[model samples]
Target: MNIWVTSWVAADDGVRLWTATTGAPGASWPVVLVHGGPGLWDYLGPVAQLLDGNRVVHRFDQRGCGRSDPSDDQRVARAVADLECLRRHFGHERWAVIGHSFGATLALAYAWTHPERVASLVPLGSTGLGDWRTPARAEHARRASAQQRARLAELSGRERRSAEEEREFRTLAWFTDHADRERAWAWAAQDAAAPHAINWTANRRLAREVDSWPEETVRARCRRITAPATVVHGAGDPRPAATAAALAAALPHGRFVPIPDAGHHPWREQPSVLRALLLRAIRRA
Candidate 1:
């Protein structure tokens, strides 16, 4: 499908966001996809195909990521502001938000702050609610091979790293199953390796802010979100499934669903299942 690409100043700070619209342009239900990696570019191009026929899908690179303009301010609040700016630019009063990984955390923040602007919320492979690093580390240790573990340990002990090294560490830390790991590497090679494809500086800064975020505050915000919410998690993901369940239960209108055997990138590992869940969420929304 042909995606309509455009660039707009999606923030008051003059950061231009590269955005694409796919699916039925006239669809009443407009859904915005927040890609994983607070820094991961808008690589949800393939995933757009699944929702394009029925719903209008919007995807954009967050500030300093992908095709978006570079900026020193990588705060989570800035990211939320960018989303609001996008909504206003699209003239949508309210829309459904589907976020993956760290993007899910952003989506939740936006929903909590502007519940009146969200029709529904779908958080996929979300983290940031608690001390996710502990469980993630445990899972990595359990799943990584001897070589992978050694490499991870070496990277973890480093006080600093180059962009490529950071990407490599993330690939190992995020994906457990061999196929998923391979796919992640391929994705990084194709998309993230390009010049200005990823803003590592911004990623590092924003990630620290996300990690420092208080779980109690996030849970408190989730409880106040009035919009319907669904937490979709891959069973094979490093983050514990209990976290997703608790997040869903915390929301006033929330449900949790886990996809068996799927890893972090469910779109690659289990496209059909993930697509089905997205459709269900949209229908209910």
Candidate 2:
């Protein structure tokens, strides 16, 4: 079932969130999914299979992301507050959270402040929690993607891509399943058709505004969290395993699960493994 999650933020600005509920309204177990990009959609189509027992699984797009209205009001702490409001409004005393990429970033922020609210966290395709040199890596990726766009006709229209779009497309394209050369070409073609301008803007802003977060901010909160924590990462992800390792080390009850062949978007590339890992996390959650 799809539930409409609405809330107000810093200003009197109201935001409407799209939420997908797996089965019942109040299940014994609940997983609140936080999507990546702060400007990206939940992309919950593939991961829907994990809600087998018809438990309550929720996915929501942050303000200015997905179907939500657009806004440049950027702040990490504010996003955390928004999440807390949503959790309380949804009536979940404590929830297991699964954050993907930027969502994982929010997970760190939320978990840090409200450990009692989140029972556990399953961060997938985490962007930067530990030691991610995101600026340098993203800058390099931007240049590489620009080069790719120039050489390949499939990337014709992407030559004028924003720096963030270049980085997102180039990196995310590498994780897609093309099946063959033809499919790869087609995929590239599709990517060039519509560049992600919004995410690019948000990413650039976020990179500039927030570079790194200290564990102390979130660590003290983690210690209080009795819920088991597991991190699911794509083995093929370009972000690097060291980042995840560092993040896991910071947390007292953190376990890392690396899925083979999956890139940045583990759930998209390795659905079976993603499902299994999520199910396992659910059991543990």
What is candidate 2's lDDT per residue for 1-285, written digit by digit as tens? Answer: 444333333323565555555655544467778877655666664565455345677666676665556767667876787788777766788888788877887887788678778777787777545556664365335534565544433543564756655654554544233223234444444444443344556666765555644546555555655557788887766676767866676677888888877666565556677777887786785
* TM-score, one value per model: 0.87, 0.75
Question: How many steric overlaps are in each model, in order?
Answer: 1, 0
Q: Assess candidate 1 and give its lDDT.
A: 0.80
lDDT (Cα, tens digit) per residue for candidate 1, span 1-285: 656666555587788988988877665579999987767687777778877876788999888887888888888888999999999998888899999888898999899989999998999888635466789777767776899889978997888879988777666655563236546556534543445444667779888887776777777888879888989988888887787888898888999999987877777778899888888887676
Which stretches of candidate 1 lie above 4 Å from their native place?
Answer: 153-174, 177-197
Instruction: Find the 10 residues in a row with the least total lDDT in model 1.
Output: 188-197
